[model samples]
Target chain A: MDVLTDEALDLAPCGYFEFTDDGNLVRCNTTLLEQLGFASEELTGRNVETLFTLANRIFYQTHFFPLLKLHGRAEEIFVTLRAKDGSDLPVLINAVRRPAESGFVNVCVAIPVRQRRKYEDEILQAKKVAQKALEENNELITAKEQLEAHRYILDHKLALFKQRNQDLIQLNRVITHDLQEPLRKIMLFVDKLRLDEGIRLSASGEQVIERITKASRLLKDLISGLREFVTFDVTENPPSSVDLNQVVAKARDLVIRETGFGAVDLKMSELPVIEGFGEQLQLLFYHLLSNSVKFRRTDLPTVRVEIRSSIVQDNQFRILKDRYHYVDFVRLVYTDEGQGFDTRYTPGLFQIRKKLDARTEGLGFGLAYCKKIVENHNGSISTESEPGKGTRFIILLPFRQSDQAFI
Target chain B: MNVEMDIIRRSNVKVWGSGSRTLLFAHGFGCDQNMWRFVTPAFENHFRIVTFDYVGCGKSDLTAYHPDRYANLNGYVQDVLEICRTLDLKNVIFVGHSVSSMIGLLASIKEPDRFERLILIGPSPCYINEPPDYVGGFERKDIEELLETMERNYIGWANFLAPVVMNRPDSPHLAEELTESFCSTDPYIAGRFARATFLSDNRRDLPFSRKPTLVMQCSEDLIAPLTVGDYLHRNLPNSRLVVLRATGHCPHLSAPDETIQVMTEYLGTPSLN
Candidate 1:
């Protein structure tokens, strides 16, 4: 039971190695042999340097042997040992010369690098990545601060821009607004002069004054039209469900009945109750139908209004879970036989004051305001038209309030 | 300080788009939010595009531009982050042009959770120096000369032209009409703005970004050289540098249709699924 059993020592954690005086391996434990990729019996009498690379062997012969001989001890020397497969094993080895007994030489042990060192390397790499990101974040925050400051400055510039444009239009209206009182006062004075017996005027003078008054009245009408177009309810508006049939009937009564157009063929369909501004949609239809009535053959004019559902829409019903909420759409189509212009004029169709033809007398804000009203209802409108032929207008919108809320 | 007020200020941001993914666009020094207008309409139905200007450059309030705080580009980047936080924008695709491109990098590095990807249109981290073995293609002296030309020529033209060009009858924010007019803009502020845009260092922010990124480098870009794109590729762990077919510093303006084609394609392609 007390005998020296190499099997027991071979099973230890550390590798045990023994060498003769001439540097040949006398014996090695299972751990050391296994680390060198060899069996313990195979390394029993091999050269100790055979476990090292040739370069390592040269260092072992020149420096390691002398140091071992001088002090008969060396501890924790970092080195690589050649395995049986010719792969290098990183190790920290302790070598010491044993007292020579029956031609024995030295002993050595290799302890694999402590687990703490490998753990430190991994943590350091991760830390470097985190630190880099932190630095970048800091820099980004600083840049954002500067951009915010720029945005502040730009906001005022834009406000001034809005204010200045409004001021220009405001001036025109203000001038026209005050001019009305002065113009009325002048009219009263001219009437007084005509009624007074104390003053006598030529027929030419009377005609001239009448002409001036007529010109003034016409100027006021033009300014009123411009003002109506300029002042739009753009800022605050809410979406509500409205009936299309009611709006279309009202449009026909006002545009066709008042204009005295020949028996208006009105085809009303069961339009869906859509979520939008009811008045805005009514105004849009009123403008389209009125424009059709306005620009017709004077002697015998016929107006037909067709309302139908549109399958073509700007958006499709999409179901999104992770990225966004779902979206739903309902479409409506309006086709009229009213005269439309060339495709080239389509770009200018919605612009206020851009009169497409010289034949029309009214200001060109009719179609322009229609565009604005449709937009206010969270809906879209575009027209397909030809010069001699009629126009087909399409509108896309959300059918329900809940669906519009997702947007 | 005025956080609630700031929210109301950006109320004009687009409300009628139906796209799935949202891209927050930050323009460069001299321009406003409209710089992205050329490409915004192209992706309106597919991708929700968010565009806004730095305080002094666009429709943003000019009084917010503090010269002392905004003496560099880093201050402008903070505004971008503010826009993201205020709107509760997450997993966004940040599309930045010129100086804003680098600004986006700096922001993404700090708040990776907010930005899913970065598309740097024309970015240069370092503006003045021509680092060793690198071609920055401009000297500090050259920029000074350009600044002198802006003062001597550009300002007068801006002031005179703004009134007529911006007189659209239906335009709500009418001052934009003056943007191109003779230098109606203050000379001192414009000059300082130029200096802030042209000088900045953002190389430190490159390695820290963990989000996937795409650098859409314009070929023959006189402003940001190709070497800067390569530098970003080497530093960012997962990054791709794509050289676009077009040339010029502002692809969004000079080549809008092609520029929108490339951006819409990238914005439409989903990273997941």
Candidate 2:
């Protein structure tokens, strides 16, 4: 029989050991003893757990021993051993369990793996770093996708708004040109008929002609108001600095001349010049003053009007912070002592043809035109009123309009 | 498939044996239900034996694995209770190994009427030492190092063993043999399981369960030391502690005769079941 000699076993290149089923070391080669810096007597009867570091001891029980018991062998199991001097020595182990006369004999061979372990650890660390970067990249991609979805929705909504605006412009052209031409011929022929046939006409015929002239004039006023509201496109006019004092003064003269309400007292304060459409700002104040004179109380001989202006921080209005990037806004307050309507109708007051009182004169497009003009200048207008009290209009306009504000 | 069949297929549940009373064997973290082969045969004659693999282990459906759900021990506890409910199992005798011991205890606490008794082998409520009061036989750093070691070994196996298995296509049996030797597990799922098992602390849950429990501990278990066993015995109500003469963590695999004898003796004694 050819058998390995004792001398050859002792001088083997790798370490070897044999233990019983209960893990008490029965024998170990000299090479293993030299590797662990232990004498034969020190390791002979000790349990095999003493040979491993604390972490590898867990690995041995949980993985190595279970695998050996189930499959009768374990290969290429990585473990770290604790030498006598308390330094760690990494090794790759292969073990097998075989039955002997007394019990099972477990044999193991370990190869010292210093350089291989170092390289493997470095590779593992690099892999971990790469995995982390990949996760972050995935999160960034998700955020970008969400932003793109929002932009797509906004673009779709803007296109719908543009289409609706085009439809309204077509309807306004038909009302101002086609409808007004026939109505103008009726007024001219009615005037001619009244002048040429005055002697032959009865009292009832003259009364009917008078009513026809009044109704046609009211219809004409409504069509022109509708046209002015619809055609005030802010994009056609570039913004420039305009003084609020000058706009208010010009608006007051036009309102008094148009209404013939000479008993009017107007008060004002120093106002700031802000960047906005100049013609739209003047038209906005004209509609506001005209609304107050039209709703004046007949019992009071004179109408009182006051205008105040100041600069306020943008955050003062909670609704403006999300939409505007401006720091400061110019606040203009217009108050008048006139008979006011029910405040419940304030929400729909800015809508065209929304009238508070059917008995009152003129169309209900005054407040609506005021709202459109204010908004075209990248500003806002809201009103507060109570029956039998007075009316107040508050306006907020940005000192410098943002380029993206129109859309 | 129906929901009942789905549950059975999801966990790869296997039912056998001739007796009426059921014995459900739950495997530990690293391996699957096949670990109970040596131990299950002994009880097959007198008791009905039930075994299953947790999702992502053995032949269980891998698609059922959700990372957020299985991030902690509660997910595994849910799996156990769901299996019990789906099978309509009542008064079950649950036998668990390693981390599964705590899992069984938690399930019994959640539904006390479904469980009759528990036999915990090599159970450690906590793996890392709390210091000053408790010694669980390991520190946090040691557990981390164990994870690193596991990664090294898994990567090493993929690089070293894949080529050898592929080159031997002439013998298909050789490939099957190699696969059987190394329990097939996805490396990523195995890493997650290791984290959930070793980082868990179930010491607070010990006092809540009052079932008849048998704590079978090995004499020199490196995973769950003698102190941990004594700790369990003191805290677990209506419990008994028996230290086996066997060594290492898994006595059921190494010394099945002794394991079966102790379990049979404990069952034979008249108490609750």
Candidate 3:
């Protein structure tokens, strides 16, 4: 019987690990250990879902393991891992059935997708910016002027050109901003062709306008995304000791010019500053607040932002400070009596990519972006909602230890 | 939004007069304070004249008509008092045309101070038919048909009807070829005026008025029949009933010379002794 030596397994490029069907880590190679940033002794027999956030556990239970059990395999499944210190590590895990004496299905391979994700995400962000700018500019240029038949035809042509320009601009800016080392790959080739060194490919013919347009658009997107990302990122955390009443007023003023809110009632308790990102915390608070304002709930146009802040011990601090500090964080248990969404989407509350509410012409990125911002700040976001009773997001984080935490 | 405009009987009833007596000429429906242009001028050097439209019927702001409020005859009467009260007019030789004549009676009943003498030209008290007892000019069904005609073609009140009522080529005041003659009080006020003139019952209002009324009954009065004038005189206390030697409801327009003569005798000398 031939078997891979431990040395041979250590040299393999992909991460290899074996766990029981119950998600207990049984064994792993050095490559897997290093990929996971752990030694063999530290990882064995640990429940795998514990390493994943609750959402990833659900993903594995729903899709990853079911496929493995049925086809004795699953391929290229993307999931985020909880880092050793509780940060998200996005990865693509593939698994194949292996012979086992026990009821274990297969060994799994995890490929870290950090670089690819950044590239795709940056491209997406750049494309979105260019598209948004084009739309806004077009709208401003043609306010209520739909009577002209020629203008409609021109708008159609411009849309296509705008799309092409988006690609070129995104590629150009992705290379220029140098957010990551590898984003340069997409732009450098386009730049070289612009220098007249290469023969004009059919697609490259429009590269004159297309490439420059694409580059300019990419730069524009990156700048805006960076600004927004920075802005949104700072606001992702759950408010620990936030004066939500003040926050409500602040947020309402922001959207007052956009919508009409005749009245808003806020029922809130004083908040404590827990271990959270403040700006992001305020933003998460503001996003939910503005969302309530934007929808108008035409049936009941008056929006009531009720915050249910409780004095529960901060679980994040309890879990986190078990080893590091003596701080006890505050658990901000707030509810939004807002435009409720379908109950089926409750599963996606903490997911970075789920958007269920399409009630408004929203970016569908508010909640998802809110989740990302929250997670980036080391806070956990969750929600329980029904169709009509309205939606409530529950955020738990280590708060600043003080009576002044809440106002 | 219904309002009662105090008609100021233009203190002089004339800004500048070279006259022995004041010539007060009140306008009929669908006109403003400006309808005394032709007749008042003939009396300008001779006497002082006064005229004005009821609230909704003219250049007055249409925002003044409160529908649920002013839905009767006394409201118009009160409007008349208010005009006198505001103008502080006295010894007014009140000359009212058609509905305005009864409006003058209604006002005189409440306040006899404004009118020295009332000249009712083509006045009708009850507009609807009343089981042989009432001498109303039109039947209830006929009045309803007029209302339906108004409501059905509401804009026509503004276009064709408003122009004709104001100053059309076929009507009086072709001399005043004004353009704003077209843009007028709201169509709503016009409808309310229609209801005020044709729908209200002022039969009992005549006896309450004790002023010496001069009834100028017209032969071809579509709105106010000559018999209606007789009915008013039968009910009124000291009214002098006179069958005007003219045709249509508006004697001041169709037979101005005859109307001026009758108005001159009653208001000019009061009692020429």
Candidate 4:
């Protein structure tokens, strides 16, 4: 056999060692001894398996040894050696079984692979991070699909709600239009009977006819009021800038003419010009003022109107936070010395024809019409009342609202 | 939408020949149904021949190739059984190449009545050597190196490897055609199939097949060496091992005449050509 020189063997790039069949280390090179931080004497008699970590020791016995025995060599196998300082030395090992009389001696070479192992670990960690990101991306896709499905359902329901609302309005128009004909005929016949047959009728019979005629005229007024209320197509009307002070002045003129001027004291505050339908705004003021004067307390029959403006943060209850761009609102408050009802009636106040006081001779559509007008202007109306106390109506109108109305 | 039709479309099954008895030929790892082109022509006059591509290879439906479903060999065996059930074929002579050999054995073991015989060409029960008793002829490192080789020369590997693996380097045109076919396969599917083929160990499953199996081995095959053929013959109960004088892994491509001769003799059919 050709012999390798001592310098050639010692200066090699890798560590070399020879072990018996039982894994006892017989001899090791200077590079291996240096890598292990050990003296040659300390490692010579030790079991080579003891130099490895517990797991690597088992791997060496089970996989590495069997491979070497079967193929006469094992290449590029991974193992970790226990160093003198209790740290681990990761390496790639190649071993060859040598021929012997009784058994075989194994010659093994190990190359330090700490840098390679670190790169491999980084690759594995990068793989794990990539997998996590993929899973999260899948979850996000699923969530987006669910949101799309919910939006579809909401859009369908909104369409149905709009259809139902249109149908109800159409039905009201038909009923009101049809009721006017019979009312006109009844009034005409009663007038004819009083004019053409007055002498033949008894006085009690004539009095009964007069009462019937009066009730029919009242019914005709109520039907016309409801028809006018439903006919306001606020959604279709384009808005123009109107001064609330002018609107209030117009409403006050109507109230004075109806109540014989100077019947109730009406106070007005400085009001700003806002974008709204002029006719609706005028009718809104007319309804509130009429209610105040009609239900005024006998002792103190005055109504005060105050107007103010401020910014308001959006909330879920009254308005949708995302639907509007304008945050500023104008508040018009009306406080009157009227016979107020219980606060429990506040919810029913805005409902159509819901009267609070039975003694007050009203069709009870005034406040409800006021609420509809306020809503058309992209505003809200609310009331605060206490039994035996006065009533205060607060109307909140957006300062510079654009026409992105939601139904 | 019919399930049987779906299986037929997924496998790209092609049926030909006149005889009532069916010869279902399943292709192996690297190539597709085109690998049986030279050998099937001889059987066309005698038997009803069936040929198909594995999912993800050749013209089979690429969308139907799910990694989790094709992760193990049993999944492929299920495909073979589905083909049998869908076609309603009886007394089938299942001829499998390379990895498909073991795949066919597994199918016959699960449903013995569906198959009449199993013909395994260049088959290995285990690719890794397990010391004193067995020699599969390739070390684990060699297999790893083979995978790396595939990675490095994947573009030209089909052309380059076919000639070498078939031991016909002189016939470069044959390999060029193979290269075109290999390029047709989806790269991701090919990689997955490669990993499954090399890393699997089916040594313990050899004894489970009750069907009479024929092990055809080549003399100088690198992938499945001679000792593996002997191992298969010994483990299988009613089996025979034939050592062909051909020099490479693919006898059907390299020496088609000899392959046809042996198959016809085994089936007790006189030579027609």
The backbone clash count of each candidate, in order, is 51, 0, 41, 0
Q: Output the number of the DockQ-best candidate.
A: 2
Q: What stretches of model 2 exceed 4 Å from their correct place?
A: A1-5, A135-407, B159-181, B271-273
Which docking band does candidate 4 fall into?
Answer: incorrect
Q: Which candidate leads in lDDT?
A: 2
CA lDDT, candidate 3, residue A233: 36
For model 2, how does the per-residue alpha-carbon lDDT over A9-33 read when each residue is reduced to its tens digit? 8679988887776878877787888
Output the number of the TM-score-best candidate. Answer: 2
TM-score of each: 0.38, 0.58, 0.36, 0.40
Task: Put down candidate 1 lDDT per residue, A1-407, tens digits, no spaces.
Answer: 01126667877888777775455577677777677788666665566777866434433532344334333455555455778998866566678766565633678888765463366446655755875798689769967986797689779888998998889677766856776677778777877877789888899988877887777676667667776666665534566667777877787777766677656676655776777777777777788888777765344456666776522212222232112222334455677676667888887788887787766767678888888876665566787788657777777666655444334
Q: A187, model 3: CA deviation in Å?
A: 99
> What ordering of candidates by lDDT runs from best to worst?
2, 4, 1, 3
Worst 10 residues of 4 chain A by lDDT: A315-324
Ranking by DockQ: 2, 1, 4, 3
Q: Give the per-residue lDDT digits (tens) of candidate 4, residues B163-199.
A: 2222123333454344333312565566667667766
Please give the distance, in angstroms, between residue B33's alpha carbon in candidate 3 and its true position after superposition.
4.3
Q: Please, what are the lDDT tens digits per residue for candidate 2 over residues B139-252?
A: 989998888778788866653223223222223444444444244367777778888899988887787676899999999997999999999999998999999998888888
- lDDT agreement with native, every candidate: 0.64, 0.81, 0.57, 0.71
**Winner by TM-score between candidate 2 and candidate 1:** 2
**For each prediction, how big is the interface RMSD?**
34.3, 15.4, 42.8, 22.2
Winner on TM-score (1 vs 4): 4
